[model samples]
Target: MGMNSVNTNAGAMIALQNLNTTNKDLGVTQARINTGLKIANAKDNGAIWAIAQNQRAESTSLNAVVSSLQRGQSVADVAMSAGSAISDILVQMKEKVLAATEAGLTTASKQALSDEYTALRNQIDTIANNATFDGVNLISSTTVNSASIKAIANADASATIDIAHANLSKTNTAIAATLSGLTGTVSAGDVTKLETAIQNVSSQLSKLGTGAKALDTHLTNVMKLQDTLDAGVGNLVDADLAKESAKLQALQTKQQLGVQALSIANQSSGILLGLFR
Candidate 1:
């Protein structure tokens, strides 16, 4: 226990302790630099790591939500495009129906117009059936009845954005069967009915447009939420490389100084030998 005892080197013990401390600090700095993260594991900061892990999970879930929204948006866009095409076809049909109403039309001429109108009507049905995305057709009755597109609004799946299908089938009352019974002879009531059908097609287009807009807004929101979660995770775990680099240099210097001090402490015994000589 004596301070001057030759067998017990107190100065060396103190220097060794300091060197161990410096080595520990240097290891920590090196690990941070290598990983680019201050909180790489729960051992670094348990609470922060837990929060960052949760945020990462939520961000991953948001990716699936964005995908769902995109699919829904595609279906809505296809339906809208089909509706617009149908609208154009209906206008052509109306013109043909008007031509049939003319006074001196030959039987062959009337039949030709009726045939063209029928072809156009059948085209509308074909377009509706084909306006599908990922097997979900918003305009077809058979598919629309079974399609209920819903997007997740949260990681827990507790909330959702629902998109209802719009049935634009030729048989649907919304667009009534005005062209189904058309013949060589056109009536005033048929003209009126065609006018109503045009209005219904317009209404369906407006509805589809509204739904598309809603989907776009939801997609934007999902992207923003994902960005926010990413930022949160970065704040929790990301390291400041510049700061850690500076610490690394400082620790290296301290480690060298510790080694030199330990060498000097061990040499104190040599000084005692010199006194005896």
Candidate 2:
């Protein structure tokens, strides 16, 4: 072969060897640092990276669902506590009326009791009106959170959490003039009127209890769904540390072998150099 041909052949061979060593070392270094066989897009490993990326997107979406569910839980808790307090006041009101049934309560005392009953009702209304979370009130209105997240490249996903407060209306007991024992000619048959008012209050109390129980049910479901989402996210994107560590060890060994192979290739080039001399 001519000098130019030999020189060209040697250069091409050396370049190919260098390229091989460089690619091998690059693979090892990437595996060591990333601890992943595929660090970049799906093009690197079409099947594996594609699955990983899809799983990662699903995990991200589930995380958002969990967060929204958590917020829904908070709203439900506050509503539950406030409802309990209102129920307590209603029980106290019943006790007061029972006390008046035997003891001759003065008109002024009856008026005072009525005023307190009204105040308690107003307080419940206030709680329902003002119970807000992050500038949104759940007790007063049914809020549906259209919480959305763009986790996938070309797909849109959103979730809605319905926040509904239990019915907080008071079980009102209408005042019977006879119950007050005021000097007004309320007919004897009006005794049944007082009983009816108390009955109305009791019936309403039962309805409110049912409503509160339903709200509690919603809260339970929210908690369960949140836990499920958390578990799903963990399964999707969370790294398996033990597996990654094993891969790291293998990559380190590959790196050392790549370096030694490169040295052998350089020695082969030196043999060609001896022929020229």
Candidate 3:
């Protein structure tokens, strides 16, 4: 317990220990600054890290849901566009049929009206058959059996939104048959059939519009949820750069002071040589 023993300098030992602790703390602050994360890994805070990781997974899964919803929206949009075109053509066909019904019409004039009506009718089938998006057709006869576009609605894939199909091409066949052999005339029945077809197309368009709207609304919600989850994860793991920067400056100063203190403790042993002199 001598105050000035060269072999057992307690003061020096205590100073070295304090300096080592300061170095350790400085290293931790530097790491936080470098990574911009207070909890960069499980070693930082195992429980909080685990929770953030789980939330990150959910956010990633929501990306898939957004993609599915977007694809469904595109399919619905294409179908609705084609349905609207068909509706317009149906109106034109009705006009032709009505004109053909007029009295004292010349044979040539009747044939001309019938030809225009048939062409418009054919266009409806063409548009419906071609209305496809990402290989999904909501208004095509080929997809009538499957008859719906389905999209994932949630991160867990537990929920879904389905947009039903409308087979305009197949329905057009009835109109075609009704007006067959219309070289010089159109019957009252043909006009009635065309009117019904036009109404059906309108209803189908309304349904498609609703389904597209659902997709848009759901996509927006999912995006918002992803943003919120991302913010939550950030709260759990992200570092406060401003705080860490301040801590780093303070620790650096403390480390320098610790080195100076240790040096002073070592020099204290040199004072014993002065007594011998």
Q: Give the alpha carbon lDDT tens digit for every residue of 1-277 in model 3.
A: 5656888888889999999999998888899889999999999899999999999999999999999999998888888888888888888888888888888888888888878877887787788888888777888787443268889999888999988877777464545445643565567887898788777778878988998999999999999999999999999999999998999999999999999999999998898899888
When 1 and 2 are scored with TM-score, the better candidate is 1
Candidate 1 lDDT by residue in tens digits, 91-188: 88888888888888887887888888889888877888888888787777774443756766666888777767666668768466585634645777
Task: Find the candidate with the highest lDDT and give its number.
Answer: 3
Which digits, one per residue and each the tens of the lDDT, describe model 2 over residues 1-277? 5354433455446556665765675565555357433345555556755666665565555555545545555555555565556556556555545444435667777666666655654565566556555554433433442121111111133434343334443323343222343233334344455455445444544544454454456446645654655555455444565766776577666556666765665565456667677
Clashes in model 2: which pairs? none
RMSD of 3: 2.0
* Backbone clash count, each prediction separately: 0, 0, 0
How many residue pairs in model 3 have overlapping backbones? Answer: 0
TM-scores for every candidate against the unseen true structure: 0.93, 0.55, 0.93
| Model 1 RMSD in angstroms | 2.0
Candidates 1 and 3, the one with greater lDDT? 3
The TM-score of predicted model 1 comes to 0.93
Q: Supply the global lDDT for candidate 3.
A: 0.84
